[model samples]
Target: MSSRLLKICLIFIAFLFFSCSSSDDSTPSEPDRSYEDVKTDFQAIDFQTGVNDVSIRDINGVLRFFRVIIPEGDLSSNLRPLVMTLHGASGGNPDAHKNTGCFAEEGFAAINPIIISPNGGNLDWIEFANQVLVLSLFDLAINYLPVDDTKVVVNGYSNGGNGAWFYGETQPTVVTASIPMASSYNTFNTAGEARRIDVPMYVIHGENDELFPLQRTQNWVEATRSAGTEITLEVAPGLTHNEPCNYVDHVKNAAIWLENDVWD
Candidate 1:
């Protein structure tokens, strides 16, 4: 070969060697096995501080907003109870916070999980995305909210009351007590498949509720209680669906229940 040809062939060989060596060195590594190898490591007592207006990405990668009510004073290893109150499908986050008094009251240390309310849309809490949003809020509270992880309470009114039942039945582990008011009866299509729920429930319904007849709400309470679940059914006489008893009786009942009950 000519000298020029010999030089070109040497350069081509060097390029080939470099490419092969680089490929070998940069082979894709085995993926991080930490997430897969270990089950979800949840230290429920890690953070003692409280955060509000927490915008967390849910299971569907949607950004949902939540307000957390943390216990007063230093959150020592001593676990304090956590109560989560969800507002009905008709109300906004601010309304939920206001109605439940979770932010106004300094006592409960509760979290109000808010799902947005649109003027015209499917008006049911069964929407899969909505449920996932609620679950994500629970996860955020469980992982971040400083409280007694074991004493989680779920409560709501109207659309929110139904949501309380749904969450109690679906995520039984996180729900130690349930408070539902002015709610109609509803069971998910996967009701039987739901994790067994023995969580104590408190039902608040108006005797004169014309919107959702009292019978239905009463039946819901009786059915759940007959299933051997601890429950307290309070019937407010001469009250409408949107009864003031939510603030007076329901909140009082919730306080009493939490003070006495212990969850497994």
Candidate 2:
């Protein structure tokens, strides 16, 4: 072959060899896994069905407390949904757990969600420190339990309901849904806060609640809905401020709604 043709032929062979080598070295990328894809290998606790108290210092250096209720099941087999319950003002962690009936024998057999109730230091949940504390406790729960990160629901009564709105509005990505009962946002800027909420919400309140009247909850719901938020409000007739006694049914229904309606 002529010298020039020989040079061109050699260059073409080198290019083909480099292209084949590059194709061989390239790897097919793995699909991205979401939070739901990640699972704890074993049960964090021994699957005892009761309330467990947890205490830890929050980001603000304040001593914070929370309670967890594990259902009677083999956590090793299924990753259960998590429900973070907030208590009303002056309500204890255990009291909130009992009031909600989340740990009741029948209740556990029904919904089977892992429950976490965190104390708000007797302050409004809109308080920055309390918000930080609640989020911190959530992180701790996920790390310590066999919690399904994708199926987290935040619900509360009275003051806790208020906190539920706060977390549901601000941390939509973290909390999947919100259920607030007998609560109104008396502390936060409801109109401004509503614009930030992106998750679905189920709100329940007593029509005759002396502390937080039903109209207030209605107004908040209206404003939130106007802000393009998905919310449903249920007003119980003749119910008063301390309506938890008459509200357990609503709570159970909400749990069903969370499972079948929202998450489904």
Candidate 3:
């Protein structure tokens, strides 16, 4: 062969090898669990009504914490909806699980969905790193558990409420709706996230919240509503920042709104 033809053959071989390698490369599904290990954990789930502690290592090698609430029933039911409950500013998922029992219980009034609370720790919802970790965890749950990806409800309080708004804005197509309580619009994109909510959003704020003042939330809510997004703000009569349990009834209302109005 001539030198030119020989060079052509080498170039084609290199191109083919690179194409195949790029096509085959993929990120690991989870940090620790193998495919068989995932199967084992899925099978080992108690499937009873209780809270279980779970952790997943993100691509950054950080251990993300989560508390999952399993419902009382057989696991053979059709794919179930998932309620992601985000805690406030600190203590991560444990703070949410212990103090917000009223929320997990009454928030799902009629629809018994799998409840998961992720620990925010040092990262806030607005950060790209946190979004990656959270979305990875979410993908893991949907893959291993019987989760219906279509009907996802993200509810949050304080900083997590800000996260609720962030996800609703970022994952509008996947998230069915959001119920944010006592969340400040001044957080997570500086509440710029509130302006981009395409999915239905129902906000619950105390009339007398000292943290992240109610008026700021109201201001953003009004602005967002002017843009024609479907949003409802429910102002609790006399609730305060510290009393999360008091918002159970409000969350119950948001649940009814989801079942009767939104979750078609």
lDDT per residue, candidate 3, 140-246, as tens digits?
A: 45656777777788888888788898788667655778888899864224645535468899999999999878899998888777777788999999999988888
**If candidate 3 were superposed on the true structure by all CA atoms, what would the RMSD be?**
11.4
Best by lDDT: 3
Off by over 4 Å in 2: 1-47, 58-62, 91-109, 186-196
Say which candidate scores most in TM-score. Answer: 3
Full-model lDDT for every candidate: 0.52, 0.64, 0.69
RMSD of each: 17.5, 17.5, 11.4
lDDT of 1 by residue, 1-264 (tens): 334224333333222111101111334333333321211322322323343333333222333445554545655565566666666665333334444443124324333222122111134555665654455445544544455556677777678778777767766656667777778854313554212257777777878888889887776566666566677878877888765433454566556656765442
Local error of candidate 3 at residue 262 (angstroms): 0.3
Write the number of the candidate with greater TM-score, choosing between 2 and 3: 3
Pairs with steric clashes in candidate 3:
none
Tens-digit lDDT string for candidate 2 (1-264): 334223333333222111001112234333342222222311233335676654433222344555678877688768787788877887434244344453222332356878877667657887766665566446545655767777888888778888888888877657889888888773226345545368889888888999987887788788778878888887777889875757766666777777788878
Q: After best superposition, candidate 1 residue 83: deviation in angstroms? A: 1.4
lDDT of 3: 0.69
Q: After superposition, how far is residue 223 of candidate 2 from its true place, in Å?
A: 1.9
Q: After superposition, which runs of candidate 1 have C-alpha atoms over 4 Å from their true positions?
A: 1-51, 57-62, 91-98, 102-123, 187-197, 244-246, 262-264
